[model samples]
Target: MSPSSEEKNMKKWKTPLWAAFAAALVVLLSGVAALIYLDELYPVGLGPRQPIPFSHRVHAGVKTISCFMCHSEAPRSSRAGIPPLETCLLCHSRIIRTYPYIARLRGDAALNRPVIWERVNWLPEFVYFDHSMHIQRGIDCGHCHGDVSRMDRVVKARKFQMGFCIQCHRYNRATHDCYTCHR
Candidate 1:
């Protein structure tokens, strides 16, 4: 083939290759965005293995314990706080006194050691959420928490990103003022 013909063939191949490259880049970027949305950039990765295997189903379902019974601060505070270890001991001190896990908890309590539980649900630092406000407005815990009473091990049921909260606000006709959440 002539040099001109060779150049024409190269350019033809280059166009298809460039198109393929662009398609691949878009696919890769899309995959990354999906992962970020699903993961929600938690300090602990999805479905974290807690130090002690706590069973929400056993406590909240079988025993009929209210969520606020353990997480007492949720009704009055901005944070749906992690229950202090003493909360567990209230019933555990007698109910399953000799169980290995209960014993371990007893030991930890004796030493006054804190349990650093892996967070199951979280929101970003910039967004301000008041658990008390939501509760007072009659939003169920399962609205964001996905029915922990039914779960043996709690997992993040959905993404807690901006769009998620915005959708709820829109559905409820709540104010979307920037300062309401942004501050």
Candidate 2:
């Protein structure tokens, strides 16, 4: 083949390769940018809504209640158990019995109706998270949950994306196995 013909063929081949490379780069960068954007918005803390507008600011900050006191089961199970009605009654049974806001709670508990607490935190169905393992490992709840020690209404603070999870594991030199969280 002549030199010019060989060069033309090489250029033609290179064009597709370069285009594929550019496309792949765009996809990779987009995935990374998407992960970053999601991480900022959808954190791994509470979702939204509460039954009685329970303020962590009051209970955790002013009253100094430990996080474990209410989310008492976080260190033991995948699901953090909700505070039983009896737990609330421990204080409201007498402390605020006469207050109109609390009177309804008293009436409901008397009737055995579970308080309809709106859940504030949740993960997507595909991800399997073990609160016990994280807690047992002495991981700071604030790492993924943000500084709820100051929040009134709980909000999602950590974007619980797969990349975010892997990044966190990498930072802590922990295992980032797919089966660890996928199954």
Tens digits of per-residue lDDT for model 1 on 2-54? 56987888877776768899999999989888877777543332367788889
Clashing pairs in 1: none
lDDT assessment of candidate 2: 0.80
Which residue runs of candidate 2 sit more than 4 Å off their true CA positions? 1-47
Q: Point to the candidate with the largest TM-score.
A: 1
Question: For candidate 1, which ten residues in a row score worst on lDDT?
Answer: 39-48
Task: Give the TM-score (vs. native) of candidate 1.
Answer: 0.73
lDDT of 1 at 46: 31
* Stretches of candidate 1 exceeding 4 Å from the true structure: 1-46
